[model samples]
Structures are given as C-alpha cells and as structure tokens.
Target: MSAFRARPPAIPTTLVDDAVTRIIRWDFEPGADTGVHTHGLGYVVVPMTDCHFLIEEGDSAREAFVAQGAAYRREAGATHNVVNAGSEPMSFIEIEYKQAL
Candidate 1:
C-alpha cells in the first residue's frame, strides 16, 4: 500500500475486466483527486467530456486540457495524482491492457 494519503478519492466504475484488459469509468468532481498512485499496466484514456487536470508527481505539477472524444495512452508504472482542476466535473474511460496469460 502507498504511504501517501489521498485527498478526495476519484470515483471509478468498472465496465470490463477480462483476460486481456480492464476498463473503468472515472468520474471526478471539481477539486477531486485520484490520489498518488502508479499504473501497473499500460493504459489508454478516452475523455468523455472536456477535462482540465492538475497532474502532480513528487513536487512537480502541471496542468492539462483534454477535449471531449480525445484519447491518450500512457505506459505502465507512471506515478502521479490526477486532480480535476476545472470548475466543473470531468470524466473519462480508462482501459488498462493486461499482458497475455
């Protein structure tokens, strides 16, 4: 378990969890956060709505803007806290690829 404490936890809803992939829907209210964590598997994120994010890793932080219908992919083992930096709620579909068994 992580030693760091998470603020408001982001809500995650599982849509699929099969042999090769795991899909989840994440909903974040303004100022909510996904906590500090690492991605164990490579993942893709499809934005369900336009999103403004504050991504923090260690002491560094950056802002991101993703438009609705835009998608992005990340490699495994990336660690950071994802926060909703905008005034409204934001959501995205996250698909994590599982290695073949």
Candidate 2:
C-alpha cells in the first residue's frame, strides 16, 4: 500500500507523444504546486529557466534549485508533489520514456 494520497493533475502541455518518449512543457507560477503523484516511467527534466522546487513526499520534504539548461533524470516510481518555491514564475521541459507494453 502507498502512503501518499493522489495529487491533483499537473499543469502540462504535451509537445510530443511518440513511440519513444512523451515530451511536455510546464509553466508554474509562484507558489503553484504539481500535486503529489508517482512516476510510472523514467523521465528527464530540462529546465527552461532557473527554478526553485519544494518537493514533498510522504512525511518528508526538501528544496532544490536548478539553473537554466541544467537537466536531470529520475527513475520510475518516484512519488512527490513539486511546488514552485521561488518568487518568480518558472518553466521546464519534461521527457518521459515510455515503457514496453
């Protein structure tokens, strides 16, 4: 059983959904949140602008800062709610690798 509750739908704009990967663009306002959710597929995030993130998972939370153009990847099954912690708005590109069906 999972400890986290379902999160609200993330604000995302799908740019590409091909056989290989799903690419999405996300724009977040200050204090906005991307509700708690678990990743089903491994993914990569490319920052379009510098970002400050408050990530909450289960009973714990932490903050992260990534500069523009810096990219990071995460494996599947990561669960968390991502919040915009900075004063300004931020945007990023997310690419999720599709799993074999």
Question: Top TM-score: which candidate number?
Answer: 1
Which digits, one per residue and each the tens of the lDDT, describe model 1 over residues 6-101?
456789999999998999999999888988889999999999999998999999999999999999999998899999999998999999988755
RMSD of each: 2.8, 4.3
Give the least accurate 10-residue stretch of model 2, judged by summed lDDT: 1-10
TM-score of 2: 0.86
Candidate 2's C-alpha runs over 4 A off are: 1-10, 99-101
Structural similarity to truth (TM-score) of each candidate: 0.90, 0.86
Clashes of each: 0, 0
- Candidate 1, superposed: residue stretches over 4 Å from native: 1-7
In candidate 2, list every pair of residues with a backbone clash.
none
Model 2 sits at a Cα RMSD from the real structure of 4.3
Global Cα lDDT for candidate 2: 0.86
Which model scores highest in lDDT? Answer: 1
